[model samples]
Target: MKQFVFLIDTGNETSEHKIHATGMTDALKRVQDLKNHLNDNSNSDLKIKFKGIIYENAF
Candidate 1:
């Protein structure tokens, strides 16, 4: 598995999430799922921005 570090910018603040996945495709899917969940549950005015992704060494 590989580690993917996602940098999420919410306008007000930024958050980091580390995800373990088989590859880039899996990592992207996971990130999309998280964005969808956040969008569905958060206030309408809240905007989610994806700053960047860091592909880490395999573990």
Candidate 2:
């Protein structure tokens, strides 16, 4: 199995980030959709960057 870490940053005056990890191919692609959904709901004047995944260890 492979692993991935998604570093999400909501660029703002107060920069914040969260990490999510998964091994599923479908889940990895869903990050973009989820991020978009979140952006639409938030009233914040900021945009979040969906940083690419980081592979950890060999299969």
Candidate 3:
């Protein structure tokens, strides 16, 4: 798995997420999942500013 730093900017607020995924595809899936969760619970419209893998295990 890899570690990712995701920056979500909602017009009014900004948040960061540390995610673990195997690859880019999975990382995107995780972001979508997070978007869905936020949409379901929050009222603001959030947008992703930066999404990239920060670190990977040396295994």
The candidate maximizing TM-score is 3
Question: TM-score of model 1 relative to the true fold?
Answer: 0.70
RMSD of each: 3.3, 4.5, 1.9
Lowest lDDT sum, 10 consecutive residues, model 2, at 12-21
The residue pairs found clashing in candidate 3 are none
lDDT, candidate 2, 5-42, per-residue tens: 45555554534343445644655566667677767988
lDDT of 3 by residue, 2-59 (tens): 8877899878888899888888788889889989998998788888855667666565
Clash count per candidate: 0, 0, 0
Give the number of the best model, judged by lDDT. 3
Reference-based TM-score of each model:
0.70, 0.39, 0.79
Ranking of predictions according to lDDT: 3, 1, 2
Q: Model 2 has how many clashing residue pairs?
A: 0
Off by over 4 Å in 1: 44-59
- Model 3 Cα displacement at 25 (Å)? 0.3
On residues 1-59, what C-alpha lDDT tens digit does candidate 1 reach at each position? Answer: 56777777666677888778877799889988988887787654444444445556625
